[model samples]
Structure formats: C-alpha cells, structure tokens
Target: MPRWTHYGSVEELMSNPLQHLCDISKKAQQHSITQNGMEEAMDYLHKLHIGDTLVTSTWKTLFAAYRAELAKLFNRIGVTLDITSNELPFGRQDLTTPIHSEILTHFLSTSEDRLDLSSSNLGTPRLHRTVASPKPLLVDLTSTLSNLKTYSRVIRIAPEKQQFTYAQHNHIVSKILSSRPTPTLLPKMETLLIAPVTDLTPLDGVLSLHTIFDQSKQHMLKFARDPNADEDTSKSETFDPVETADKLGVNAITFQILQSKRNKLLKFEWKRVMSDVRDPGVFVSYLYARLCGCVLFLSSSLSMI
Candidate 1:
C-alpha cells in the first residue's frame, strides 16, 4: 500500500497485548522444556514409564504430606523433629561425578568384604552340565517385586530362559521334594529314553548303559540294596506302553518320534541300497522291506507296513 501508514503508531497500538501473549508463550515453552527434562531423568532412574504428567506432578505434594504425617507421629512419640534439616532420614544423596566414581570403585572392589569369589568347586572342572534355576528365581523375584509398585521395573532386567531340559526339570522337582522333612513323602520319578534305530555308535553305547540302569529290574534291585548305586535307576523291568504313555503326559512325543523317523528316511542313501537291484519290482519290494524294518524299529505299531 502506498505511504506505508505510520508503522511506528501500528507497533505502539499492538505492543501491550502482543507483549503479554509473548510472555505467556515464552513461559509455557520454558515449562515444557523443564518438564521434558525431568521426565527423561526420572525414566533413566526408574527404567519404566512414570505415567501421566498430572499424576507425577502430585507425587512431591504427596511425599510432603507423608513426611508431615511422620513428623506428627514423631512429635506425639516425644521425638523432636529436626527443623533445620530439610532432608528425610533415608533421602537420596546428591553426589558429584568424582564421588559417584569413588563409590562405584568401592562397591566393585575384590576384597572379601566387598566381593567373595571363593567356592568349594571354584577351581574344579565341571564334569556334569549345570542347569540353572533362572525361571524359578525370576518367579520368586517377581513375587517380591509385586509388593512394591515402584520396583516393578526390575523384572525387565531378569533372565527369560529357564535353561533346564524336561528331565532336568523333573530331577530338580524331585530334589526339592526329597529335601522337605515334613510329611515324609516321595516325589514320583520319571525317565526319558531317546534311542537311535541305527547301528550302535559310541554315544549310542553310552545311552545303552543308561537304558540298562533305567529299565533293568535286576539293576533296580541292586540299586535298592546298595544305597551308593545310581539314584536314577528305575524299578521297572519292561516298558509298559500303557503305564509309560500315561506317565508321558504329552501326545507331542508321538509326533516327535514320527518326525525322527522321517529324518532318518530322508538321510538314507537310496543309491547305496538300490545299486544291486536290476528289476523295478524287486527294488520296490526291497525298499518296502527296509521301510517296514525302520517303521518297526522306530514305532510300537504291530500292524504290517
């Protein structure tokens, strides 16, 4: 527009309201920045969401109320409140970087009072595989944490894996049951037997020895007489399909056994077996026989394949 109508006058007219709005906006921006910084720091300390700003903002007021209540109780009990000190009895300390470093160094010291590494088997080579009770420990820890709402964030740092196999799990349960003095009850023991249908390898031989201990009634009798014998030795002589199936508690084992059979079949050398076969009919018959033998060896089915 022509003549740019009195720019100084226009600025003067809007100055008061504009300045007020500008001041409000600046204050709001600063508040937002401070709130965000506080939230970030809190999250770092607690390792979990602290919830809404409205809720969190009231915590300081709530804490003050609690402190006042405690002070009143102390006064009623004839204990004088320290008016000079604003700090609570168990208040968190404000430490400098160097102080924090020193505290951490003291905590991590290898001295006996700070850290103890001695154990009966500390230097011994581990002969058996060690299965940790991480899941049970986590469950116990979770139970303890459930009592404290603020400490619920610690669950995220716990281990997820149980680290024990089915047999090991059963053994642990049995051990726990045996250790209990009251009621004098014994836990039902079960065994897992995994056998390959192929020729006996060294591992298979070892497993055969295990099976002898697990399945032989004579060995079980010997174990009963000799307390020093393997505790895992089973009392049964023959594998009773009905009783065994009932104890198994899972139908998935059947599927697993079938899958194992399929794997063996897939790995079988067809060329090696059928190389001498000249006739297609004879080859088919021979393959059928081999498959039947494998099926019998792998499964308990008595029907003709």
Candidate 2:
C-alpha cells in the first residue's frame, strides 16, 4: 500500500519542497555500505535498514544496517533520496505524528499547563499506542539530578535480548575555551568531521559529550591519515555541538526525531578554520548539528602535510 501524494507526470515529485530528491538522483551514492571484518558483535546490523524491519514469530531485524548509513551519507553529501524515501510516517492514517512527549511534558509541568506527571502515575513502562480521551498522561520522573554524572541503561526487546546504551551518551560541555590558557610555541592544524546519526540510544544520564566526539576523531583518523604526525592540535581546534539544549534528554518520539535529523545535512557554524593539525584530541564533533537545523558541519581538523 503506497501513500500516494499526487505528483505531476512521472518526474514531478522529485522537484518538490527542497529539490534534494533531484540532487540524489544525480549522485552515485555508494559510500556507507562497507562490511566490517567478521566479529561476534553487530556486523550484520551494518547492513540493515531502519524502518524496514524483518518480522519473525518471536523477533525482528532491520534488513541492512549499512542501508541507513548509506542514507545518512547521502543526506550529508546533499543528495536528496528519491521522493518516496522522504514520505511521512503512518501513511494515509488519520493518526498523523505528534509533538515530542518528553518536551511537552516538561512544558506542561513548568509552563501554563501546570500539570505534573510523576513516576507513580506513569505505571508500568509500555505504550499501548491506544488513543484515549483527553490523552493519557506521560508518567512521572523516575530520577532527579542535582549534579553532573555518568549514567547508563540496558533495554530488552521482549522477555530478553538486552541492548546496552554503551557509548552513546550526552553531557554539558561547559565553557571550555574562555578560561585562561598558555601560549603555544608554534601553530597547529585542524579538520572538520560530521556524522549523521541514524539512530538514538534510549537512556538517561549526564554525560560529557567530549567522550563521543573524541571517539569519532579516532574512527575518522583510522580512515584518513595525515602526513604530518607531529603537529600540535591542543589550541588549534574546536568541537562544538551546534544544538545547545541545557536539559539534554529525549523520550522515544523526540529521540527518534533526533536521529532522523542527524542523517540530514545542514550548514552549521561559519567560523574561521585553523589550517594546521595542532591536536587530534582537541577536535570538535558536531553531533547535534542536524538537531539544531545546521546546513554545514564546520570543524578545524588542523594537521599539516
């Protein structure tokens, strides 16, 4: 069953909204589908699609993990997928998508609504997806934070098979560059790396975003090597998360939205770049650039040749 939105002739749909669909048509689009060396881990997922789940009696799997990665790469490179791929969710159903619950709940509690949902009211943690009158309330807060700290969660698909929210974490990267600093003896190098997030880790904790940003630089470095191995990077780089939400957390819906946007390319910060490699460890990872509606991912991967 196709959700049909009338497009003029056979080619009209590709020209709509952003003209991105047209862009992807002109591109070769074959970069994110590489197979990882065999390991007992998640190698198979490197080939799965996000939405197209494979159904079995007991469980399911997305066809190819690399598929979505391909999609994300296409997005980053300004390739608009075919018009069909951008279709809205729950096609043709009266039940269109809605606002994010976690954000709405926060607004409800603190805004004009004045209602609060506590853990006691949320009950057991499963969504029936059954619509109720005046809307069923989102449950209360399970945890409270007074200071910054690390956190983690492991989720189960059914009675078992837990998925660990391991490295996917977030935190407040406070004012880093404004403090006192000593002068360097020489100049440094830099480069910008952007990765579209096609997925989200459903967990909660105050995480130092630097953790993931640092990890990504290493991953990229594995693929891209610099000739100048001894260049300084400490003062020659910056890794800024474009979307700066003080309270960084998302429920299922908002969480998924975060991922969807991550796959889309948008121009982000248009600041000056350092043309040298000063410190690889000081590179910025623009993880939330998509979430913040950025069109370009700008970073200074400053390393000399």
Candidate 3:
C-alpha cells in the first residue's frame, strides 16, 4: 500500500495544504512497515512513473546504513530524494515533501500561533522541526579553529603541489581555492620559507595530505617516464600503507638530523630527500630563497648609498 494525498501530484499538494488519506497505507501512517510490505512497496514504486524528484520514508536505525545507500543509488540515477522522519519519536508530518515558499509561510504562521498559545506555560515551548539543540560554544570554536588551520595549511602548500604536475595539481588547488570567494595571498617566497620547514608531520596520520600530494606527483611522473607501463605494473607499484608509514618515520628522523647540522654541512643541504628526488631546485629555492633575497637587498642598499 502506498501513501496517497488528496491532491493528485506533488505540485498540487505543495500548492494546497497537506491532506494524506489515512486509509491508504497503515504502515505509512504508523511510519513503520514489515519487510514483506517494504518489498511490495518497492515493487509498486518501480512500476510508477518516477521522475527526477522522489520522496522516501526514513527507516529504523538498524536499517539506517542500507537506507543511506538506497538514497545514494537514487541520487546516482538522477533522482532527488526527500526523506521523511521515522516512527517512534515522530517528526514533522507536513514537511515530508519538499516545502515550497507557500508551504514554508503556512508552517511558520502555524508555529507562531502554537508559540503564542504555549507562551502562558513557561515550562515547555512549542518545539518544531526548525528548532535544533544548542551546540556547545567551545565545540563550535574548536571545530572552527581546526578547520581554519587545516585549510590555511592546505592553501599555503598548494603552490608546491601545483609546481609538480599541472593536471592533477590543479584538481587539488581548485578544491581548496573554491571554499571561499577570496583566499589569502601567500606572501612572496622571500618573506616566507626563511627557515627550513623540515618537521612536517601531518596533523591527521602517517598518510597525511602532503604524502598523498607527493604520491600523485610521483604517479604523474611515472606516466611521463614510461607511457607504455602496463596497468598491471602500475597497480603493482602501489605503495603499501605500512611500508609508507615506516619510510615517513625514517624520513622525519633523517630530516631532523639534517636540519640540526645544515649550517655546518653545506653539502647535506644540497642533498635531496631519498623519498622524493624530482626537481630538487624547488626545495632549494624554498629553503634558501630568503637568504638570497636578504643578500641582494643589502647589496642594493650599499650600492645605492
């Protein structure tokens, strides 16, 4: 059995008030259906001329994961799904369908009247779909700061990734850039990167974003080197997570040692990291650009004076 409204179509229902026929589906009214009933409903659903828009009843938490997959499947096939709340603690019945401007106005007005009536009793106010539990101020602040740091770091490091491979690099750059209308312009290389940023342990894990970016660069480089590399060989070349973690740990230790002795050991500064060898010039420029800028600036000042 399917839920039927007094209005024939979604458009007509949206234009008019919500009027569901109580007798059509007992399960729909109750917001819980048996497995057999669900199968039958799905069969009936497939038979109907479903278009771009779809509406679905939310299932129990036990079926939540599968229900989400079902929603995704609908989306993949170009259907826009409107999910209604589940049975026990019932949610808004009227908002089961996507609300239009008129429907929104009606709901708001109805809520206002309810609030006005409930005002006499301060113990409980009219709770509605529009209201949500207040989030903790600390939680919100921490989340904002974390996101800001991660995104800021990503933006700062984007140019380095961009210099590696144009196509793949642009994909990452575009995603980070699109988060805001205007992005903070990274200062000239001369001002930044004055010190060797040898300690870059990702905030997340061993397989951090920088590692992923480097992996993509290496992948692009491999394709450039041997365009005829078989798909099988390419698949075989995939880095093992455990092995990568081990190597990253080793690199971190080695970088620490090198950074400590960089002033005394000029040759070590020129030496490239074993993990990455392509375009050592970029690292050298990043590590020493500020020194070059300082020397040039001092020389110019002396010459001008």
Candidate 4:
C-alpha cells in the first residue's frame, strides 16, 4: 500500500475564493485548473451567498496589515484612528465573495459622518459595448479589499484572466478608498487622499500623505546625518563642470595629472547645479556654489599646467 499525503483538496481549495484567486497562475492553470476553472471558482462567490463568516484567513492576515499601515499613516498625519469592528468574521461557509459589503463598509469607514454621496459619481452606470451594465458599485464591494501584494500574488498565480482588469481594479479600489468620509475640521475643512501607484515595490500607489512625508523626512535626515555632506563642504572642492566645460568648450575633460604618476582623468562636465539637480535647500545651494568654485579653480589650474 502506498501512503499518500494530499495537499489542498479540490473542494477545500475551491472553498476559499481568495486562496483560489491567489493560486491563479499560468502554471496552476496548466497543472491543476484551467483559466475557466479559476473564473468559475470566482464566479461561484456571490455577495448573496456570503454568510456572516465571509472573511477568509487570507483576509484576516492581509486586512490586519492593511489596517495597521493605515493606522500608522493616519496617526502620522494627525488623524484619529477609529475602527468600529474589532473582530472580522471568517469560517468554512464557502462564500464565493471574499468579503461582504457590511465588512467592507466597516473597513472603508464606520463613522456616521456622511459626505453628500451626490458628489460621488458612484451613481453613474457602467457602460459595456454601448449597453449599460449593472451597477459595478453595487457589485464591487469586495474589490477594494485587494492591494498591490494580493494583485501581485494573482499575477504570479494566473497572468491571463483576472477578476479585475488593471484599470478596473484600480478604479474599484479608488472608489472604495475615496468613499471614506472626510473628517470635518472647524473653521477649515480639509481632506487627504492617498493615490495608489502602479509600481509594485514600495507601496507605490498606496502611499498615504504621512508615508510620503515620513519618507521625505527620512531622506532629509539621512543627508543631515552625513557630517561631510552639504552642511560641511569646507573640505569639498568646488567644480562647476558647466562653467569649466564652457571655458574649455567641450562636454568631456580628458587630461593627465601633472604628477610623476601621470594619471589620466576623463569626466563629463556637470551641466546642472545642485539646486537644479534637486529641490533648492539653503545649505545645498551654498555648498553647491562652493563646490562649483573649487572645481572651476582645479580645472583652471589643470588647464594652465
């Protein structure tokens, strides 16, 4: 008798829509399920069929991370974090949809504050090939639950047919994200929206205002930490490649060092100043000028020699 260890059973794999969605891949399609098989697996999940325990293990893991990140982003931007739902429901109910609208609403925004839903074009009907399609807003409640990581997983699994087209995914995600009610501030009303970037790495499109600010702050701090950086350019020689190039009338400078070793030097002229290279900072501006001057003097001396 041969002992057999089964991985995921067909029914077991099919029960979890997110897992199935994540498993979608050309290889998976070829080896286990076809493209249509995956599609059928996904279509089996309808919002109506969803029970109280609609959230999946995948949802629990990913949503936890998502909420944590969002909380940090909100905190950084001076926004209060309010989550009404402490526990997300999950189970063996075999719901086709990954999550329900109620759960999505909880995830989106649970506050009573209502923005004029009228301003939102969610009321707009989707058109398909000159015929109006069903209200995607009504059907796409679960769409916003996916993120770049999950999308990447989907692509990794099945590249051909996806539940949502790139544009469709973005659009649905954008709608769900933007549906969150804006906090009302007395005297002045302000809103912050984080745009999702298509770039797979570094949470490209999903970066919040605070995340961007924090990144910029870190970059500035990194530069600040360097003692020999712009702040202390006393030792740095100034070399305005542009001016030197103009004076020499060439894009590149190729010359031999006047020392006995006779080292050859070939370098391109620096056409852009530091300020031009990056956004202007007081220290950078001054340091760049000093560096340019040093370079020019060096070039002039070398030319004379």
User: What TM-score fits each model?
Assistant: 0.15, 0.21, 0.17, 0.19
Candidate 4 on 1-305: residue-level lDDT in tens?
A: 11111323333332233333333322343467544543343334333221111212233333332233223223322333233322211122222233332223434453452112222311222211122343322123222222112211100111111122334333322333333343221101111111212322323222122222223323333433442444434445433322222212111111111110221221211222221334323323222222221222223222221
Which regions of candidate 3 deviate over 4 angstroms?
1-33, 49-58, 61-305
Error of 2 at 102 (Å): 20
Better of 1 and 2 by TM-score: 2
Against the true structure, candidate 2 reaches a TM-score of 0.21
lDDT of 2 at 148: 13
Candidate 4 segments whose C-alpha is farther than 4 A from its true place: 1-57, 83-276, 280-305
Cα lDDT over the full model 4: 0.26
Prediction-by-prediction clash tally: 0, 43, 0, 14
Q: What are the per-residue Cα lDDT tens digits for candidate 3 across 1-305?
A: 35432324432221111111111133453656654554454344323321111223332221222223223222322223222212111123332222222232332344332211112311221211112554322233223332221221111111111122223222322322233222231121111111123233333212223333344334334433553344433333432332222222222222322222112221222222323456433322222221111221111111111
Question: How close is each model in CA RMSD to the real structure?
Answer: 29.1, 22.2, 26.0, 25.0
> How would the candidate models be sorted by TM-score, starting from the highest?
2, 4, 3, 1
Predicted structure 3: lDDT: 0.26
How many angstroms is residue 136 displaced in model 3 relative to the true structure, after the best TM-score fit? 39
Segments in model 2 whose C-alpha atoms lie over 4 Å from true places: 1-78, 85-208, 226-288, 294-305
In candidate 1, which residue ranges exceed 4 Å CA deviation?
A: 1-164, 188-305
Report the C-alpha displacement of residue 113, candidate 4, in angstroms: 18
Model 3 weakest lDDT span, ten residues long: 152-161
